[model samples]
Target: MTKALLKYTGEVEWTPPAIYKSSCKIDVLYFPFDQQSCNMRFGSWTYNGFQVDLKHMNQKPGSNIVPVGINLSEFYLSVEWDIIRVPAIRNEEYYPCCKEPFSDIVFNLTMRRKTLFYTVNLIIPCVGITFLTVLVYYLPADSGEKVSLCSSILVSLTVFFLLLAEIIPPTSLAVPLLGKYILFTMIIVSLSICVTVGVLNIHFRGPSTHTMGPCMRKIFLHIMPKILFMRRPPYNPGDILYREDTDGDGYIDGDYSIDSCGDIKDGSKDCLNYDCSNFKSGLHDDEHRGRASVADADNVIPRQLTPEILSAFEGVRFIAQHIKDADKDNEIVEDWKYVSMVLDRFFLCVFTAACVLGTCGIIFQAPSLYDNTAPIDIQMTRITQYGISSPPTVAPRL
Candidate 1:
């Protein structure tokens, strides 16, 4: 028997097999079969390949090779995989299409692309919902139709989360890009709902001129509740809402005044009757609800906003300043209240940006998607004393 030894190029940084000084080898054996398994026969066909130890796979650095009994002339491909699907680990072999080993084994590999399904879906929707948040700042608050645009976006975000959960297998795996965005969409949606509550809260407090501007009142009453910031106190008893026959007409007084909050200091000036005898029923109050009713509500107008509402809504003072022109004070108060509605939009933007940026920061830290991401190497060889040279085929990078 003639022995052919193939040497390692050392171009591959690997420890040598102890049996060989400078070479590792494969022995080729040719067998003749008159008949194969009863059902099958290679009547006119020639076959090639090798059997390698499953434990000691031979491969170059940065390569995944699955060894099979074959030669370079036959075929070239090596695939790596884990039998158990264990994460971050792989098992593989190369059917170099040959019976030779070491340098004589020639192989070629083509890379396959891996797509991140979660990232695409999650990211797009995250951006879409973020845009709607900005839209909140632009739409008119008093449409009376209720700022419904926010509700629509909020619902969309919920569907996105459900969709993501369906597509991805739950694992202790690092959070996926898409999963993060879905989470963000949900967060933004929740925030938008809160903002809507704020708008409603402000509107519920009667008109803009009476107490805090509607917008300001909304933030103080509703949205802030989520942050545990403060609760909007139910409005107070109009300081002057007492049952008295002021003009002896026998009808009790039903007036609401900011001065209701005063503790005898402002003196009964606002508490006094407005001389309603000459005054007709308030056409403005009749147009709106939540005001001095036929009598003050049993939950009577609050003497003042809940102390908590008073503290969290510093923005109310800002609205009060806008009522500059005395003649138009009422109208300006309403407008300032309108401006306050945006506080909901403002807070959501702040939170959404934080969530998106945080998700992006997570992606930047992932493994680089490039040539070295996934590696494949193939090998094929034929054993013979006579030397045979094969050309290296250009392989695609992963």
Candidate 2:
């Protein structure tokens, strides 16, 4: 049987299997809860004019569907998607009596991103930093670290926002839920920083910088503290506030007085009530009175300030007035410190409420995409009017 067989040829043309790589675009507007649809179109390039025809091996639409089998190792990559539909149609050349016809396949895929990664890395950190903003008020201003701590937290939040921007694509169609949260957090932190700076400025103020007016002292030291529910430190009589010497005695009274220097004695008359009845009358008595007056004046005022010549009385009066004014201003400075404390308590409550509301508003706006079976917007069609030479049109729905 082998002797009767014909001889075989040597060379044969080999055709490599066609491999297609599709270009896919991603949309991250609704990231961590976003949905995407990718298309993979298949067609033949060689033998276009009816010599080679492309066909779905199976006629049913379900039979032509290809399953996506992507398996990523990252646990944060819990994204789920599906190859939900596959549509096939014919494309014939739009020319009279032309024979170029081909089959086209368009695959539709839909996916939803899981939020595991964002919840752990983005949401938690942003939320923690937001609550931390309130701590700026809790810190004592005397430590001198309130502004520095608040500024550091502000810079940290900005760095986190920059990192978020790098991860998500730049798009304005929709803001990501986590991105909104971060933005809200950034605003709150910035406001907290401003408050911290203001509080510190108020905290460090003294009589040398600003004099607290009587109306301001009454409102801030007494009324505002009650409204803010700030606790008053236990009253210590030992730490008594300085008072004006209203009785002309060498001691101060326990009441605030606008004209505080009434204790100074002049020409044997009591300055407190401006009474001169205690002086005795006579020319010889006047001579003794003048000498006694200078000696008494040295006792009432500082000897260094009162000149021995008796003619430089104006210098002693000027020095005593300056010392009185400084004491009065020192009292006002103490009242201002109390006002700063009351303001700190007030803003602490304000920032806490703002943070809570902003966090809830930003996070809950994201839509849920689970168990959705809506029809996809993908379509595939053929050019039925071949003789008209029009552009290819979508095929009629099957």
Candidate 3:
């Protein structure tokens, strides 16, 4: 039973006169998180940042409390606070700003099954997207497919770069572990794409092609691995063209002739005869003929070379030998023509080296992220240190 009184003339009055009596307190509650496949818990928890957790605007008007001062005499207060979620990943360390006075309340961390989601989802996917640049090489250099692939990869790199930028805080401030690795890999991938475009330009004999200097070639050869070979298998004679080795030997059999076995061109396993002269000629040269073929015509009889034509051939061959010397002299002036090819190969080598180095650099530079320090003790000590003191007063309230 408390007596309620108002001091007008002399209604009621209580409580001894004091200089001032007020309270300033901070209350914090760390939220428990739901587990996810990703190893990291993203977002921040701070006075000012951005987050989407606990802000009950109307909860008892004070449960989510950050009371600066409570003046029971005259109520005038303002609360300045914001909440954010801090991400913590395994094998990484994170220390909260505990020495900031506040009543801490931490909900048990939601144990999530950590995964290499950064590597698996973001990194690997970016790698696959980057590898698309390599696929462009399979297309004919002169075909539109090459340009299309390059343009597409460039656009993809731009999007990925933008995404990486979004997740990163700029201003030379240290970037997050995930962002750093992602950004590094993306940079290399983007450079690889640019190099692919250059390689294609040189392959297509574009004017932008430049000679690869000897110094650069030597440097590339120095760093290149002894077994650092990444190439499509050589074109097989039997695979792309044809072979006539009846004895299963690699060389064409000497007996291979159209006149010797005509029907055996069907390539029957049981047929011991094989004519490969037709194969040496391109498929375009195999013109189909009617049943009474043009070859059977009297007017179309194959004429043997005349003595005059034979002599002309001999004379032409003899004169070509003299021209060979002239051709050699001409090549001296145009020796740099092959320099373009050398430059193209050099650019490819440099681009590949950059990619490997950049990716490894990211792997080596990733940072740790973890947090286990008890925030309660930090808050208590901070409050004690910053607590307002009474100036030699006999008694104090709060």
Candidate 4:
């Protein structure tokens, strides 16, 4: 017959120091919200079945066990996990014939990672660096660092991700929310670098390097700037009015008209300061138009010639060729500058949208860790109670 104490006091008291070993495999899904259950089995090693009975010291009649003596704030690990304790029971199953049940106390530590460390060290810095990516669009393409800056930042983010990997344990179940956020931001930053490369390619193009196709010119130079509210550089009036080669001709066209007598007149200036007669006489002479008799008449009259007029006409062709070459070179440089502005405006719109969306997506996915609804004690109790149900429910399935 089992013994029952006849003179048992309603108040039960027992205390003892013991060492407990834990065989806990940590599950880190929902990392910062992760909970761990460490098992502590209490029993006498030699005493089998009826010889030893392990009882819960803190259990009360008509009520379940409530873990106490845990002050999470006092624990040295407060900087990391928000600790909690949950007490549970189960029998050890080493021998089939053993009749006594072993006391199983489970210390279920329900943890919520303290976010201030990650927030300050990882979140804020990553966000700040991501926001800085927008500035790459604002940088002057001519400064020659827009692509270089974006590349450096992309590499910096990669290094940051590598540093983060070293800090957090590798897991395939779920990535830490903060780490995921950093990774998402890194991808967007990489995309920014790609966009910058494209912008730089457009910025560096010139008439010598690449001719702006008509479609590209219409969209980038003409249409897109207004939609993006970009300010264009002031147009140089001389570029359109005095084009050196409006036609596809290899030679510069004279900005003048020749009269019936073959005399050149500057219609724009409403002036005729020089005649091409000396040039004509030197090249064609009496055969020009029907001026054979006129040239014969001029030969009969002797006229005094001066070194000044003759010298001016002698260098006329050289001076004209020099001016045309200078204008053509200037035109190519201006075309490149205009094309760069168009491309800059286009990429500014693209990169800004990417930055905003990436930041929002990364930050919004993290669950709120700092909820005020539950007290520390209640949180611990709830988590432990929840874990206790898992073994019974899952065992039948197994």
> By TM-score, who's the top model here?
4
> Which TM-score value belongs to model 4?
0.60
Scored by lDDT, the top model is 2
Model 4 C-alpha lDDT per residue in residues 49-133, reported as the tens digit of each score: 3555444554456544445433232123345655444444434445655665443343344545566776787777888888778
Report lDDT (CA) for all predictions.
0.41, 0.57, 0.38, 0.55
Query: Compared with the true structure, what per-residue lDDT tens digits does model 1 show for residues 82-146?
Result: 01111121233234564433122223222232333333545555666756665664465666543
C-alpha lDDT of candidate 3 relative to the true structure? 0.38
Deviation (Å) of 273 in candidate 4: 11
- Stretches of candidate 4 off by over 4 Å are 1-16, 19-24, 27-77, 84-106, 170-174, 239-335, 368-370, 373-398
Q: List per-candidate RMSD values in Å.
A: 19.5, 14.5, 18.7, 10.9
Ranking by TM-score: 4, 2, 1, 3
TM-score of each: 0.38, 0.52, 0.33, 0.60
* Winner on lDDT (1 vs 2): 2
Model 1 stretches with alpha carbons more than 4 Å out: 1-113, 116-122, 144-147, 170-175, 203-210, 213-329, 338-345, 348-352, 362-365, 368-398
Cα error, residue 111 of model 3, in Å, equals: 12
Tens-place lDDT digits, model 3, residues 25-57: 211111011121112122334532212232211
